[model samples]
Target: MVHEPRSQTGLSRNSDTEEIVALAELDPESWSAILAPRLAYFAAVARAEHVTRAAHQLQAPQSTVSRALVRLERDLGVDLFARHGRTVSLTAAGRTFLATVERALGEVERAAESVRADADPESGKVAFGFLHTMGSETVPSLIREFRADHPRVRFTLVQNYGEWMLEHLRSGELDLCLTSPVPDAPDLVARRLDEQRLRLVVPEDHRLATRKRIRLAEAADETFIMLEPGYGLRRITDDLCAEAGFRPRIAFEGEEAETLRGLVAVGLGVALLPPPAVPRKGVVELTVTGQRAVREIGVAWLKDHPDTPPVAAFKRFLLTRKGRLLSFSPAGV
Candidate 1:
């Protein structure tokens, strides 16, 4: 027989307090199921500040909108709106709740849009990653040819070394990647697209610059500017050097192949690199003889991950270009 205190809006203050606490404890599924629809109606009404106008905007009957608002306030244990004839104004509580509700609704709308975009065949997005060496020409040509038929498809391109691209693929940040040495991981699916010949690049004035080809062992005494460890190209360089019966004298370590090539051009050191997209001045590229000095370039993705339409289409297009992936002119080489 205890009488609860009442608020100015005629709501039972004690019961409203208990209800607010209980609402906070609801499980995610229960909260979402019970409150999502009510929140939409509340937002519509809050924006218009009039039930009749909000109902028209929502294309719902005015009675339905009023009932939803009443139910929402009752469930939350507070009066969210102050009624004055046919017009309504937000209570302080309503104003606070509206800010959070709007953000949640916006996130939900964006999520819907993202999923719909992924499912679209003609205009979906693909998150693709690739080696830095391929960015200048190889990737551009591949994308241009693929987009000939998929003109509306969008791409999110990332250029990084092989191992970093693989990490992004595992984390779901990348849908597909073109990487070197054709990674042999259990969690990844890979196909050898082509092999790029590695060349020994030195300054134009260096002793071996005039030779078109030489055994890798010939540069054993030369200071080498190599990519830092963890890059697939660096690993290939190390292994190839080891096979040639000499460890390269390390002069400098860098991130990008082109940057290392630039260092070689400046006479800092020599480096083993892929053929440049355009012939660079001040450096002579010599083919490595007596040892297989080529890195396998392959397309890779998570083994069991499902691809969106655009990603799947691009993957298929890439597989079709198996031996011809690079498309570099012999003159450029």
Candidate 2:
């Protein structure tokens, strides 16, 4: 099968167009020469079709503009303009090449603007990742407190499982994450955030609903409603059950913790869950008395990643608010 070269508009550019594109890639030094001189002079002349007018708009001399266009053509090994007396017009090759160079220059401008935004002290952005479980109350409360002081600071919030969030942290897509099992990667700097107590949630008519506190062994036979596997909370539930000498027989598995709580409320099965900020109706929270009935949550970021002002401010804010939640960090930091 024969494959033809395609341009930005998805149209076949034939041999000459392919040569133009290849020149930009095969000889990067030449491409860099075109870039190092800045494409503004070429772009102005291309847009106006007159070197003298382009020089006037640029406040540069006509000779300088002419020299720049000649240099750009010479470096790229393509004729970008056809001159007739004082004015110039784009050739077939010139139109195709200009299309590529305009887009490249536009991206360079956008990149500059984005870096400037990231560097601005008062109004920069932070890409924050946290567990789906923390999205309802814990994360919002913290963000509200932080925004009270830095009102213009922006956030890009991502909520996912610990494993997925950690991947984003490593890829530089996320500045920081609130996650559990506090991944032990050498590339990450993880600070113990808080440890949440897990409660054994029983339906209203279940055999053990009347009990205030029960060791996990008592529910050895009960079916469990739990978050799906690969979740940090699910790992804790499974570990707690294992320590109690039983593997959980799952009744229902779901993405949301509240949905699992709702299933328990309807008497589908009992679940091991963290207490809701507001207790859900029709379910009773039983304290799980055991050694492994808690999950560790921590803040992790790529090691040596320099934080922008907003990211630094929010990290400090999170570190300082130690007593706001019922949970406490094992290391207290």
Top candidate by lDDT? 1
**In order, what lDDT does every prediction score?**
0.88, 0.80
Could you give candidate 2's per-residue lDDT for residues 164-247 as a string of tens digits? 888898898999898888788899998876777788999888889899999999998999998888998888888889999999
Q: What is the C-alpha RMSD of each candidate to the true structure, in Å?
A: 4.8, 8.5
Residue 105 CA displacement from its true place in model 1, Å: 1.8
| lDDT for position 328 in model 2 | 27
Off by over 4 Å in 2: 1-38, 45-71, 83-92, 323-333
- Give the TM-score (vs. native) of candidate 1: 0.80
- lDDT per residue for candidate 1 within 125-183, as digits (tens), equals 99999999888888888988999999999989999989999999999999999999799
RMSD of 2: 8.5
